[model samples]
Target: MSTHVLFIHGLWIHASAWRPWQDLFEERGYSTSAPGWPGDLETVAATRANPEGLNDVGISQICHHYADIIEGWDEKPLVVGHSFGGLIAQELIANDLVAAAVAIDPAPVKGVKVLPFSQLKSGLPVLGNPANKSRTVALTPKQFKYAFGNAITDEESDALHAAWTIPGPGRPLFEDATANFVRNSPAAVDTHTAVRGPLLLTSGTEDHTVPRSVTLAVAKLYADNTASVTEYHEYEGKGHSLTLDAGWTDVAEDVLAWLAAQGFAPAGAQGAAAAG
Candidate 1:
């Protein structure tokens, strides 16, 4: 049977944004799926037209949603996630629900203590207002540029915003912002566990949403897990938009190479090992 690869997207971007990735992975002999969060509609326009379904959704709820999907699969799949989905990917892998995971510019989990100013600023759209915890928030073009597209050209940023951006529930941001102070926080990942599947955490150096320092700290938390492989890769000039912008293929290729190194590459495929 072909290996199943599940792609999980972050906030704002629609799940359909993974179409290109799915196509590429399918051509490489892998079965892939990109399912949206609990209340997400099928298309960007449909989700944007009515975002009420995402109101008040939290981190735990999103994690459970994916877990339910994985449980129904015949084999444990490899998961790749971006931003908030990155955090979800870690949560799932830490619990041994998936075969392995790649978290790209993931949101800060519970144990991450370094809160950069850029990360804070990127989160203000949701964290600035206490009421947003129970509401859905949309990012303006300017906000989106700063949070996700700063490393790319303005024209491209604007185009991506129009194409894939959608309303995101504010609850997860609030949950993550306060995770360090809360006991049994949903944002917590068992980084200390040494028996789970291998994990790869990638970050873009110019990313304003989740800075390189933040991802480095996440990697540090897993330092003591000697039994499991926890690798970190950095893309010097990339940003949060690395997954949705024109440079997405570069990131995807690196991920495929990393998977190949871990012996999870698709059958009879080269896994784009050259990219690494």
Candidate 2:
């Protein structure tokens, strides 16, 4: 059977950012798709022209939007998500919608309590403005440099900012920050469930936005799961932009290897490997 892989992009970037990943997975015999959040425009230029489309979009809306897409698939997919997308992967897993999942530098959900100063600083662009809760917010190049490109060179950071940055909904940031205090917050996940499937949580050691401490805490939350597999991996010297960084394929290969070990290797991969 073909392994359907779903790629989920996070805030400040659009579904197009996963194009390279989709190509790589397809080459390995996996069918891939990357879906946009609700109200997302077709292109970055269009998103910039009318940023208001991203306003007031909360975490629940984004999750449900993707959940519907997953439900339409003929088979359960291997879900991979980055940053806020990572949190969404976990939420979908909690709903038993995926065959396996990989959350890379995912944002924190309720009960994850290892926030570092840098993580807080990275989120300040949205969290600092209470008014942003109902508005769309775009990160300044300087802010993007600090949050995502900290581990890369200035030129690379500038290039990435130019190519991938876009406006994002502000409400999800506020919702995640206050999730612990909110009753029945959409950011909540049932980590103890066996139906969550095999979950792999990856952390970039140098990631400022979702630091190692935060990812480690999230991994620990699932430590009590006896019926499902949960594993954690940390990439040395990597940053929040790991998915888009120069070493992105390395991370992707690691995920592929893990899936292979878990008995979910893409259909025809062995034949393709032999042909090569």
- Taken over the whole model, the C-alpha lDDT of each candidate is 0.92, 0.89
Which regions of candidate 2 fall more than 4 Å away from where they truly are? 271-276
RMSD of each: 1.8, 1.4
Instruction: Please report the candidate that would top lDDT against the real structure.
Output: 1
Model 2 scores what on Cα lDDT?
0.89
Regions of candidate 1 where Cα sits further than 4 Å from its true position: 271-276
RMSD of 2: 1.4
lDDT of 1 by residue, 1-276 (tens): 327899999988899999999998887777899999988999999999999999989999999999999989888899999999999999999998888899999998888889899999999988999999998999999999999999999999999999999999999999999999999899998899648888999999999999999999999999999989999999989999999889999998898878877888776686354442
